[model samples]
Target: MRLVLVRHGQTDANVRRELDSVPPGAPLNELGLAQADAAGERLATHPVTSVHASRATRAQQTAAPIAAAHGLDVTVHDGVHEVFVGDLEGRSDREAREHFDTVYAAWWTGDLDAHLPGGESAHDLRARYLPVVERITDGVHGDVVLVSHGAAIRLAAAALLGDTAETLYVPNTGLVVLVADPAAPSGWALDHWDSAVPVPGDVTAGGTPR
Candidate 1:
């Protein structure tokens, strides 16, 4: 089985570098749509059998073009949602670093026990994400695409690659490819990973380039 994990495109939260974990979702901005389209074009050559997305609006929107081209519906999976930020949600990176020192430290150190202020821990994230991956691997026999959040994708990749959590970094709309073979002793191997925007020209929102 081959798994292609993609981080959703930029949103206002992304541009502002705010932590977005709240409900009622934020849809993708223009650059986001273009990134999603670029991602779809890149995957057009691959034999993707299914597309899965988080319930988040940005994720759903990012999955749409790919699904349309592939004639597959986006499978919404709540388990793939971004890490809940609690009081830190909507806060800027600077603000988070200033006020949530322990949380930031934990994150920097890749501490599994570090929890966001009133939110879930990295360990909690692994618990939630890994099971879904297991299910996908068990059910899908072909290439699968998953559009999700940055932190979640990083955690998933770290877990799958047996690397330190702090070692994983995925840029906006990044793609990380993993090949899982039950026949292999390791079970899974990293095939390729990149955050290169596949779009040819500079994408714009309204009249301004991002």
Candidate 2:
């Protein structure tokens, strides 16, 4: 099985550096639509068999063009949703850094048990996300595209890719390709991390992927 992990396009909250993690999340901005289109075009040769995305509006929108390219419908997966921020939801980045320092630090440190007071722990995220990833990789024979959020993708990459995760930074609409390897402990092998799109120029200037 081959997997393509894509980060959702930019959102309004992304430009503002605000934390938007709840349902529906934020809608894509103008550039985000273009980015999604470019991403679909980039995957033209992949022969994607299925397209999946988080329930968030941003992720769903990002998945649309890619799914259309393959004549596939975008399947919304709750397991791939963004990490819930709890009290930090809708708050500015500056505020979150100052108030949620411990939780944020723990996440960067790869502590599976770390989380904000009302949010999900790293272990919680894995329990929900990894199973979905494994199920798809195990069941699918052809390539599959999974459009998910920034932090969630980061966590999963860290756990699945190990050393390679250090350089696997997921930019907005950026792509990561992985292939199944039974001999690997993680049951997958990193083919590429944060692969570039064939788009001529950068689609995101002020916004970040989420």
Best by TM-score: 2
Scored by lDDT, model 2 comes in at: 0.76
lDDT scores in order: 0.72, 0.76
Per-model TM values vs. the true structure: 0.84, 0.87
Q: Show pairs that collide, candidate 2.
A: none
Where in model 2 is the C-alpha error above 4 Å? 100-102, 162-167, 195-209
Q: Which tens-of-lDDT digit does each residue in 1-210 have in candidate 2? A: 788999888776776767677878888899889889998999877879999999899999999999999889998887888877687878776657465556755767767688776888878877899889877766778898999976778778767865344643467888778788888886778888774432322222211224
lDDT of 1 by residue, 79-186 (tens): 888877777777765657455446544655668788877887878877888888888767677789898876677667777766632334566677888898665445
What is model 2's C-alpha RMSD?
3.9
